[model samples]
Target: MCSCQQHSGTANSTSAPKDAISFRVEDMTCGHCAGTIKKAIEGQLPGSAVTADPASKLVSVVGAADFSAIKSIVTGAGYTPSPDRVS
Candidate 1:
């Protein structure tokens, strides 16, 4: 089943996120999709770190990347980034 649960790495974690964005990516169906999103995010924002998991449908990013820019990159990469949680 596809999971749309929010990625809480930015909010619930004890350590502050290196970048301030974490949210649910509902379209990740496999490792390839996860990698594509990760590469796209990192490419768009050089020096950024991205960890995307297809199993959890979660993406955690740590960098200076803008949220809107990230969303655009994800959309451009044929994926859907739904809902921004905890800023």
Candidate 2:
């Protein structure tokens, strides 16, 4: 599957909270990877918003999402997510 197929675009949810935390996923190589990560996080967090960019290797999560849980989700998705910056 084309990786970009899963592109969630930017955070379009005006009502959702902004990024509470961000992750540096070194292995997130393409849109597909980002999509996978995004899907996993949203699936677990429900209302949370995720912005995963392969180019920047960053995954920002907005809403009520636990840091450890996000890490676990990224890792479970077959990627190494390091704590980047928290907002």
In candidate 1, position 58 carries an lDDT of 74
lDDT (10s digit) by residue, model 2, range 1-87 = 233435554432223245367767777777777778889889988998787777667777878557888888778878888865533
Which sections of candidate 2 miss by over 4 Å? 1-19, 83-87
Cα-based RMSD of candidate 1: 6.4
Q: Relative to the true structure, how large is the alpha-carbon lDDT of every model?
A: 0.71, 0.70
Span of ten consecutive residues with least summed lDDT in model 1: 7-16
Summarize candidate 1's per-residue lDDT along 1-49 as a digit string, tens digits.
2243453322223233745577677888766777778888998899888
Clashing residue pairs, backbone N/CA/C < 3 A, model 1: 19-62
Badly placed stretches (over 4 Å) of model 1 are 1-19
